[model samples]
Target: MSFITDIQQRFKKGTIVEKLIYVNLGVFILTFLFNTFGFLINYNGNFITDWFILPATFEGFITKPWTIVTYGFIHTQFLHILFNLIALYFVGNLFIQYFTQRQLLSFYFLGTLFGGLIFLLSYNYFPAFTDELDRSYLLGASAGISAIFVGIATYAPNYQFKLPLIGYVKLWHLAAIWVLLDFIQIPGNNSGGHLAHIGGALFGFLYVNQASNKKINFFDRILELFKVKRKPLRTVHKSKSRKTKPTSKSTKADYQKKVDVILEKISKSGYDTLSSEEKAFLFKQGKK
Candidate 1:
């Protein structure tokens, strides 16, 4: 097939995460064109302004409540989107292996919401910026990206990723480094944005942990509510069992044995007594 056909096929079969990246890229291009040439032709696009997060005091929320969500889609510059898209490209596929498209989208937007809330609250409430600036703004996908990172890392803490020069690193270590960096930098740097990062990371961690326990599962219910209904239903007659069948394969004994061991380990030395491999296997089994 030709290159264009190949690209078309990929798009047709691409996951929702990939499609969202495409949409963000398309919007960025439109904004760039409008800002550059369209302005000279009488079409000025403060396009980012339309989606940029504004303080609660500015009445922006009244006029553009949608900005709370849309701002995550808007990037300030080429490099800003470039780095984020690259991170998504690598991490997004890894996340899709276990999470549904809806769940992934939820994490993204929810992360953004948490991030924006922190930014607004800090700027308004803290003594840092409230006295100097009447209003402040934030625009980027970093918070959402950070959330994705934390989510995937939380899910599979021992999963290793190899870099060209640095060799392989465990996911949990990476998460720790990121979280620590954000914590250390919050005091002097963009306090609002850093606080937002912490908020996103917290959400990511809680999302994975809570999901394991079945405590958080809005996606399934939402999908069921919107699912299409069939026009008609067919009834089937029940058939009697032909005979008692003997099972060739059995897992009850094996499953119980493993469960007992895990329970014993938890009871004796606490849950952290389990090894990383043991924990990962248990987590995988729990999902199943």
Candidate 2:
């Protein structure tokens, strides 16, 4: 009872990443319980799982449209969920450091949505899958996890992660290996899964490219919340302080100048050569 109570409290106070993991874990346990009940009752199938796992064909999909996102929550194999939840714990935490909770959820659901669509398309279009389409279905959180991993790597390719035996490696290097493995595994047993992974990776790449070019700053909303709301004050006998403050355009121009200078240094000397201040400044501007 104490253990369950502790989990409930943690769930209440935890961040979005923890909440997602808990939801996935809960669903996994429920799935096995339902399966066990079905087995005891002499039932052949668990209609509960079928309603959530995505189907490859259009007819099958139209019946359960919600499976596009729900399938990410169900995992039958222990090893499958183990790898996915581990990856999510590390990469999802890294993701929230730079992006908002809402944005992370967006990337996750959108990635799953895109991956499912790609799987459906591939299964229907390719000659090899024409016979398998009727019997085919997709499951797992790999697509969503791939999106979060590749998304961060695309946003900051030079970012490094330290591995036990291999030392430090650039995020892009890991992302490249991830995509490459999926590509080479296309001829293997889980071709649909691989194709879905590529789709998620592609979304992550394209999304970051477009977002960086547009200079979108989702953190501005968060920053706005911390600002104190003070009433206007009357000037004391019209002092020099009465002058109007610099416009937003000028402020933005100044920020751009600093960013340009830092970017120049990175280009000339590499990101690793940057001082702590410069690296901090780059990260700040990136979120903005």
Per-residue CA lDDT of model 2 for 154-237, tens digit only, reads: 766767776899987887899999999999998888988999889888877766665645564442342244342211111111
Give model 2's clash tally: 0
Q: Estimate each model's TM-score.
A: 0.69, 0.78
Model 1 — TM-score against the truth?
0.69
In model 2, which residue pairs have backbone atoms overlapping below 3 Å? none
Compared with the true structure, all predictions reach lDDT values of: 0.67, 0.77
| Strongest candidate by TM-score | 2
Best by lDDT: 2
lDDT, model 1, position 112? 77
